[model samples]
Target: MTTSSLLSGADGAVELRGPLASRLLEKSPAMKRLLVYLWEHRAEELNEYAIATEALDRRSDFDPRTDAAVRVQVARLRQKLKEFYDDEGTLDPWRLSIPLGSYQLQAEPVTKDGAPPDLAIQDNPPAAAAIPTIAPQPVVAKPPASRYLWFSAAGLAILAMGWLLGSRWERQVQMSTASSSAVVVSPFWANLLKGGRPTQIVFPNPVFFTWVDKNGDTLLVRDPAVNSYHDLERSPSLSGLEAQRGKPILAQDYTVASDTRAVFRLAQYLQPLGTKISPSSSTELSPESADSANLILLGTVGTLAPYQAYLDKLHFRIPEHKQYIEDATPSLKAPVHFETVRESPTRIVAPGIVALLPGHSSDSFVLVLAGYHTNALISYLTSVNGLADLQKARTSHGNPEFFDAVVLSEVNGTTPLRSWVAAFKPLAKETR
Candidate 1:
């Protein structure tokens, strides 16, 4: 609230200005957004999703299930912040740092009552607030006046995000909706939000497939949910099949009815919270979206196939076509993977993974729900009174902030006869 503080870089905390802002201007657009966002919204809870939705122009459609864009960019922003302070900001009196996985950028005065004696908050600013046209005067390293300019620079950084970040895509994206459901205030939910704030629910975008016939021959085709069958153009297997029997591939809109039902079921529990449970998928999941809010992700190995990178990050992972959970790192001799015998690989007891990890920011979280086949997830959520069961499952361990679960979905023709939590293991906080 201090205003009228004469800006300076040395002997105490100073208002941000010319030098600080100039240095930030040299960083990437994402970095600039991170810095400015922290400066303005420092007092509020922040995470990757908030940065993506609010800072990165990701709208309501944004998803974080399959995308790690927010994680990558935030890591880069941290590096740049270090570079700024180590170089141009070395002598600056204030120490500013955005804690890893958090949006709170804290500012501390080098001395007690470091703000200038003249500084005071007022409804109106004095003429000195707009000091302009001062000639660039040469100063040796660590000059006292340098503090003043640096404070000005910090102010400029805040101004830049408010004006510049918004102008870039103000028309393309809308602010987060206010109508989402009320936030759930529970020990389990609190672990996800870490601050009793809203969280996002992300679904998976499965890759679709089709079989097409041209003349007397049938051809296998891969569809990318697009208007064209462009991927089949380079298929060596298809080319070989064509040589034996003439045929062509066609495009079709892939639809899985059961998968749709699973999504609807997921929404039943999540959307009730309204805006607190913003819905998105890997296809549309922006890096920042998952960072900002606690996330609930749903899919199977087939549907979640696109998120292998994220799958690798999970402590309990069920790889596509693999019948076991890949957690050998903890104990190679231990048989962690459980499989059920069946006629078809697609129809066997599918493996579902439910995991919770530190979200993009330390204050947020990501919850992953998936199975081997798409139906495995659908059956579990729709049949076992999912909404209630999920809550029970989460609290079973006394509201753990991080855990990896191995889930089994026993199916009787797309209906989960019963579901079980085969194994549970606590995972270390995400260091990577």
Candidate 2:
């Protein structure tokens, strides 16, 4: 379809209007303006200089060589368009697109088989397939024109009704697949799942000191300082108690309540996206496993002790007290301390840290979700508005490849009311 035909709100065609009309593009004025400018001048042969000057309002002397503002905005707008098509705009008759290495917006219709009309058939498709493209049916030799004379009007009507029903069925399936793919491409999930690599949902197995009496009475003790049975020897309080209780045996059977819930949620979220999810305890993880898959560590500060080296360079930390998140370097925008605030007897505000760090292998990634409450942290990471807030936070920091942020969640008792990103810091690139 022509650009004007698509934009003119033609019958069964989707319209591309102002920013107010698009949920995904509304937050970005630059992207909205760029989209509208491209649509208005879809017929023109445009370049980066024209887009920079006409759409972005760049200075007349602006140089595209040294400056890359236009390119950056175009890249972001491209991603947003893909995300929009995969999500709320899934059923739109025509899909909007911008060709790579260029600034032009192209519209392609959704063919009956779901693949774009211009898409070429591939010998082999990727394992993480979204919607499979239907192969073209074999062409049969045409018979005499009089062969169609056998069909009656009632027969033709029946065939039309069947086609309508079949088309509706296919659209329903497309919507289902598109929604799942949308999550994989979303801001929060894209980092981990979009790579199409196996994701290892690593949960912590914190050490617990247990004393079993001769009478079959057992007492369990959890000291924050003790990570291994060897570490228990160094703790004076735990050693003194061990002396009276005979001997303390180490146990790694328990996981934090939040970690369990987070694991379940992660499994439910990723499984639908056709992501290969492997759930393992932190104790089972090694350098080799880290090198092969994406890692998502879910638990409290104690659970993060094994990976403390990753946090050494990060600005925020949950100290021994486990009460507040501390920022080593404070700025006017980022506070030194993100302490818990009591809004009322049952309501409180607490801080959580969501850090995306480089893994042992350059291709792999590690996502650390550290917080006291698992529900709020995972809920925030999964929700649309929550991820949108995170996207805004990441944008403010120029959209770093790897970064960490302090997210605040308002909770009433055990229930989380809302979550928002309070501070953000772009992580330094890992040195070889």
Best by TM-score: 2
lDDT for 21 (candidate 2): 56
TM-score of 1: 0.44
Shift of residue 250 alpha carbon in model 2, Å:
1.1
Model 1 C-alpha lDDT versus the unseen true structure: 0.47
lDDT, candidate 1, 1-432, per-residue tens: 111121221212242442346455444445555556555554333444566777777776665434556667666666766666667766666556654434445554343444311122212342222323323221111123212122122222222222222222221122111211232323344334437556655555433222334442222223222222354445454445457655554422222334433443344333433435444555566555455666666655544544455567766766544456666455655565676556353234656777766666666666677653444554444332443566566577675557777777655344344456666666667632
TM-score of each: 0.44, 0.56
Q: State each model's C-alpha RMSD to the native.
A: 24.4, 22.0
Please tell me which predicted candidate would have the highest lDDT against the true structure. 2
Which segments of candidate 2 are over 4 A away from where they belong?
1-187
